[model samples]
Target chain A: MKRYFWLASYPKSGNTWLRLFLESLSHEGATPDINAMAFSGGHAAVRDEFERLLDIESNDLTDEEITRARPRMYELEAQAANAPLLRKVHDAWELTPAGEPLFPIELTLGAIYLVRDPRDVAVSLAHHMRQSLDQAIERMSNPQAMMSMSKRFIPKQLPQRLTSWSGHVESWLEAPVGRLLLKYEDMLSDPEAHFGAAVRFLGIDADRDKIAAAVEAVAFERLRSEEKARGFVETPPGVEGFFRRGIAGGWRESLTPAQVTRIETDHAAVMRSLNYL
Target chain B: MQGDLTLCGWRVRSALALPDLLPWLGGDSPVDIDISFGAIPTPAEPPLYTLPHSTLWADGRFLLHLEQVGKFWVEKGRRIVLEPAEHADESELRTFLLGSVLGVLCHQRGLLPIHASAVRINGRAILIAGNSGVGKSTLAAALGARGHALVADDITAFDTPTAMLLPAFPMRKLSLDVLDRLALPHQGLIANRPGQPKFHVPAADGFAPAPLPPSAIYILHTDRLLKSCAIDRAAPAMAMALLDRMIYRRAVGMKIQPPPALFLGLSKLARIAPVYRLRRAEDPSLHRLDALAEQVEAHAAVTRPLLAGSGTE
Candidate 1:
């Protein structure tokens, strides 16, 4: 009985465009392989996926001993899952440092979070971190803004604290008690009714021609012509693409009214409760 | 049980206490391996549980478990037991029993170990295969700061009927961001766990303790859009499929497989040494590893391996 969700976001919120519509839901006429998004399940800040789920290498631990060994490495990555995995967390709903609950909400079976518009996620997090739009709106209003904290090397993920874009969407929309939230401008104006209510909030029961063919099999002009014909190994090495401009209010044509008033006066009360004041 | 200690090139006899390693002083000693921490359990259960941190059942005896660290049972690979977990700590259960229970007991004694890192330049063995932060112990600590030796870390293993390249512990777990990006000096290192910024560095002098064979193998790939530094050479059918996917915990390397004469001795070690790839430029720039150790000491002085074509053909 392996099931775990969390696609949770805040780094250019739309979390890989809602993880390419949950990796094209349950494909029918096959358009899936947007570079093998075959049921995505990859990052939740990877430090070599908790040193491959505990064969252990955590580059000598401490980030609070790797968040107290991440709730038993997400409960043995949800009992070594056979089917439902999802993953992709951009860190924020944090806790462990001798506190607890750094995602072991009893082996979660829910979470999709997704949020956006911290002024179009500080212009797609300053072009997926190449940086600038006033340093990505001063690191989305830094509250100790982290992400691969790099002390020079050893950073293949697992440092992403990102506590500020309104405490990363109120820490995964106020954690615990199953979540689904979704709103990268409502999956860019109805990705078949917000990814078909996140595939019936993970119960999955579709309609409307298989949720409009898993929303035209993850369209954003076919993930920018498949990352302009294969280059995007999660891009961002002097970035040119990670599917940019998947349009949400172009931060009023590229923010600069002092970076859109420092992302609307430092995310004015979570952008006026997500209405983007 | 706090007695005998040799590491990665095992003779290990333990009950725990694997401090910064370094004890097994060479002499091709007859196999010993033994390690014990107490009553183990997990020697069966394995119906494809797909890795949540540990689980290997393998037919004739493998049983790896490893959840909160401990449950090892390496029966046919010459024995290892470890049970741990009751406040488990001896440098984090000997760092997951020296990586995937010493690379599944060096693939149950036939040894083809791989997930590499090696050095010994002049007397051969260059190696260095990748994929776990692809810097193979910061290029084997910049080829042991250019005096070259270091020979093996994170599982190199080979030595069966002298396919050579064995030697393993001289210390190099790294990651205090590769000792401040190779400016080195961590002063008698050793923090590989206890609030880990990963230390275990040690090697004030080249440490190749013996076993040689390899003459060139490369395969690294840091590439943040690789804009300089390339290295190439691989095709011999991609160096026999990157030595059948760089073995070490090669996901239960097919339950310690290595027979069929170890795939005809790794395709006669890909026609006796030569498998390049290399990449670079995920730039944290320590003079771009002084141009990747001057292109790996000019490709280990032009692909060594010719002490009269070191027999494989």
Candidate 2:
């Protein structure tokens, strides 16, 4: 079996940028229909895949039932042979009841973890959820509320949100897997360099020119425009767009005076470490 | 002599020949064992004139120092020699030591190791868990700077029996870049063999013994431009999702055979503690922490009475 590579991140922490860059590098020829891919939240593709395999609607089956019926589904999806199977998961690693990982850990050939400044993340999340930076920080500080909101908004398969900004990243950094840590600032500063490094780490071989072309092809602006035009939106059920503004450091302008101080106090060390504050 | 000892229902082989490694053997008992591989060092006693190997045992752990060799063990009366190689090229030995020594200790104690930064806010314990670089330490430090007690950083031990989160040994190793960002006082950086920048902070100023009752659990998510900060209750499914991400999921899974029961318990806990998704922009304002602290305190007060009756199965 070809090992799968997981592109993991906290929501809105430059995961899409890393994904697009990797997809560009791994592109053999022709743009594969992204709609056909299986994602954590969007149900259309999963339903279609299930119906095609078992001749049944997905809503009728529980997640357990789907797991039992997954082998056939996998076989059916494999018919579209040209594209490598790419799975996007937001869940953290945990073992199944059978003492096995919910997903196959051994099949995880590699992983790419993208980290961003939490202060910036807060700013972006505020805009995405239509909340103020102070409000976002306040909600985050309250572990109970954070858990409540996550239960309301995030999916069941995904991992629970950590109470602190730093706790979120530490989970993946300490995972027992080979992962390449990609900084969003570094990727934004020089997409070519970081993207190429990520591609190389994934064991994909492409010349510098090819990598450069791919990097240029998947610009953030291009993706945003593509998302807008194609209506390629995958927001949480009660939430908004997965892709908000693709710019960096918007928190400076977006956060209120009180919110800025709160975020600084909450994420002072992290912001300082990343030079965001 | 070799004997079989049952620990947590797992039968482990114990041999007397490996005396140096005996002190570290952990069980649910308080008995302390001591041994010596060669010359035994005593208090007020000079160094052994020509000792070949020495082993010291105290408390419940043992230390072995070999003159020409390093630490070694005899599994079954068969002498095993140990050689010390060059340190890791990119990571700190202290991290490894903590992970190995304390990690084993906690595992033996039926405690789960969690990847989180813990601190006390207004007498309530708050745990921050996320992937690396999500600003856990930064947030913990920020809260610490604001008078919240620092219980532990990077690793937290969840004491299942006590239904409390215990503080592991404290070692705050902040990067220089982080120090510069926070503008906090710190000693100079210590150059490990691989030359990674590690600065030390006083563990005494922040360390707290005994676990605090958990008040809230927040799953921190970042965004480029969040509109506002608000506290909302997490749905049962969402609560399950978040709990699934916790490091203790495996242990919990083992305990709760049918996962739905676990999810339901998490949902109840969610009800008892307010859970929220903290969203913000890339360059958010600094005062956000104050807002967060206020929200947390308010929520904790309301939930404390309700949570008092909630029991862990």
Candidate 3:
């Protein structure tokens, strides 16, 4: 009984959206806030849980320190080893500390790769990060900073972020994992079709009408409204804004003309390939 | 013409022409050495060595291919290639190649090459075996600091005559954390690659040329600390199972082959080796060298008379 299902994606590439969709689809009456459960987003509740699990004073540790601390974190999280453990990870497909491949090419049952137009990702990231479009563009150029920033509160680092995105998606697609590549635009346009495809890939008997309703229930407006009305629970410090403007192409109006041109110039190849340009 | 030499129990073969050695070196040799030998000639360049594989080396002979990229040594195959470059300071290149090549050859010969650290206590070999990052090197260093001589770390080559075991090499590789914990100077840490540090610790005094009659083999586990230092004897079947886990499975390649008969012989040898699963706390202070040495010495004393009587019969 293989129970672990890795929910992997590059940062801010619609992984949270997928999680919310999954949360809604997996349970009908259970209104567990998807934002609170997402590992990537700045949800106060999940941040506290991650910090306690890692036993770190803060998330400001260096990459080397984080790598050393990860094994202990995994051990602590071992109790959550219930069947179909929907694990969220940002690491590239590689062997674990024990020398066993984490997702062996032979046994990878299912994976979902969410890719967004790099332009929109850059745009949305700049607004969410509270940084200028130019600063975000520069951050994306430096891979080390990008990687370090991913562990922190801000998502300003672009190169490391995008590289991770490309690497994670490519690894699963190439591996024997039954991978489904769903674009952010496609999901926003037709959540039911894409979510259903993801469900079928997982070998689940999901009904279309119910899944569509769940998707609607977990829409960006619904989550935003919930965040606004509830005053955002202070579950974890250093991680706030459990829900921001969860809209696609939000970067268009937010980024200046020069900023847009710079991002397009910087990640043009990737954006063009994904048809974002 | 000049090459590094080390004394071992096995016989050494003749050195062939550099050109002729190219194909034998194959992909395992250092890239610089491979190019210098011109084994795989560039489109514009002519081939330097073209001797047939049969004319160069005999089958079953131990050939050492030391590649330049990592200064690695490949042993126990028909062909050997050495790469060029002079970055001999990096310990990982040296250890990785030496272990990988020797591991493949040992597998072919039916001897198991364990990813372990061994030491000589009371003139008997006590092996500390475990998976990578399991503190084998750290434990070995602790034992070494306490006056026990180091045998090998990361890779241990085993040679058995009939059923008695003998030590092959005596060196240990320590990670940065272990080195820091031991308060050892930073001089031994070699930067072979970016962000990866490999520490080389020399054998202790009176430890050279010290091959011990095997007394015990312990598989070390660092995950959970044991209440006390306990030695649990392993059954023949269980010993073989443990040995199989340590065997370098990657050297076998992709093809399916019959299980080696050497495993059966090894299982019998394991029974004689006094196999034990040593579980200890993650204590950096509890150097078990002297205590373990005493235990092996006692076991040897009891087994010696029986071994002699059986030989006489």
Candidate 4:
């Protein structure tokens, strides 16, 4: 049987970094080609996988219909998988319209939810989306915010509902499943300790030395250089880069006081719980 | 009212109106397939092959259930029974009927269904094949704009012995953005499903009805990092792999047909058709399509003389 796990997060929440580290860990301390991580399962919202597993064209279905079929898609994927699978997901943990969990609980081994300070996320997301800082801040706080939901063109991936930053955090934290939470700041400050914990949580049987090597292989500087060498595949067509300045608290310099206050105000209670306040 | 139609050379007598197929005009032939409204029984035994939303039983029975759409049961490749939802729209039901259900029927009958959109270039079929959303239909539409007649869209089935291409319905499915990008008129476009950006456009005048012999096949691909357009002729080994990957509803076909049988059909196609990989820089607006279309036409014209005596028939 194949065990499935989710690397869940809001956008730009160190999800890719964790995945990179896991890739290095699994491949015997070798840094993976940044552009070649497609074998690392894949994104949860990839339209091709949905269409392939469901045996129907996804463009013919509404977003609501797509969401309802996602759990089944994952179930079938896990059943057919020959090895353990780790899938990255940005959709907030919630129920479908039919009141079933959006992610199948029975097939999941666990989930690793990576979270970041919304103020800092706003800065990174602004660059990623090529939006003004104010626009990014507004989107971060909007409960109804969705990604890849374009009206004019059919997006490559299915629409993912990323509720308000706080809603996203709270939804994953409170969901009834096996889960581990890691802060981006904490991972940056102590890679060996945090990433080590995640490796052990997934029962990878890696020692501290192996975890340290994996961390060094995917260090922020190496990742940025690799991306700069040969453009990252995950970067959108017009985006300059995907791995920009991996740091915590860049919001202090990047965000105006008003923008910081808006994120804090919008996400105060959840931020307080996660110690982001 | 029952409608008599011919889809991919199969005489179909369907209770549902399949606006995509050509009306059956030939005299006195047995119906190859029958479709109607009926209650589909819930399978009590374990499914032989199962997808997320569909299943194929050991007895050659298939069932597909789409949320908010309906359930479809394809039995022995000869009949299709549908039990639609209370709020199912006619267009939504017909969309799956013509797409997935027909794909199943083709597999059951042991035909090679290539997931491609083809156009007739000088009365010879040139297929642009790829996965869904890879712009096969868009490229076919672009070729149509360049004076080529559309042979088929999405699912291009062929008779294995003669390697003759069967023309699908005279229609194209284009997303609203594609229509706007290509500047094509979208009047009377029927939405494939509510809230979906894709619409089915009637292409009656620009459609080619006759079965054409395969001349060339271009597998469409896009890369954001590509600096310029690249077209590479695929070797025989690579062509076999590409054609196998381009098989429509391949998993269902694999379950229905043995490997040697499938291999024989693909080998025949790979031997006869000249296949190439056509790549362009990814652009959502399809702005690069004009250049790509011109390149294809030029390549086909240059290769036409060589293929004329090749005897694809």
Kindly list the per-residue Cα lDDT of model 1 for residues A1-277, writing each as its tens digit. Answer: 5767778887877777666666676665246666567667477767766765555556645565577778778787777778777788888887877687788777788998888778777777778877777888888788888888765456677776877889888887888749989887877787788888888888876677877887887788887887787665677566788887788888888776877876788888988997878
Q: Cα RMSD to native, each candidate?
A: 21.2, 19.0, 14.2, 2.5
Which prediction has more favorable DockQ, 1 or 3? 1
Clashes of 3: 16
Better of 1 and 2 by TM-score: 2
Largest TM-score belongs to which candidate? 4
- Which CAPRI category fits model 3? incorrect
Q: Per-residue error at B37 for model 1, in Å? A: 30
- Model 3 per-residue lDDT at B192: 29
**Fraction of native A-B contacts kept, per candidate:** 0.26, 0.00, 0.00, 0.45
User: Candidate 3, which segments miss by more than 4 Å at Cα?
Assistant: A1-6, A9-89, A92-110, A113-142, A145-199, A204-277, B1-4, B11-79, B85-93, B108-110, B192-195, B204-208, B224-236, B249-258, B278-313
Ten-residue stretch with the least lDDT total in model 4 chain A: A33-42
Clashing pairs in 1: A53-B53, A60-B196
Per-residue lDDT over A1-277 for candidate 3, one digit per residue giving the tens place of the 0 to 100 score: 2334555666567777677677776675144464355422332113324334432222222234334444444444544544444655445554444555544433345667777766666665555566666666665554334343321111211112234334444555565566677888898888889878877766666687778777887787887776666534321222345466666777777778887787677666666776777
Q: Model 1, B153-177: lDDT tens per residue?
A: 7678876466677787777787765
- TM-score per model over all chains: 0.34, 0.43, 0.49, 0.93
In order, candidate lDDTs are 0.73, 0.50, 0.50, 0.85
Q: How close is candidate 1 to the true structure, as a TM-score?
A: 0.34
Please report the candidate that would top DockQ against the real structure. Answer: 4
Between candidates 2 and 4, name the one with more favorable lDDT: 4
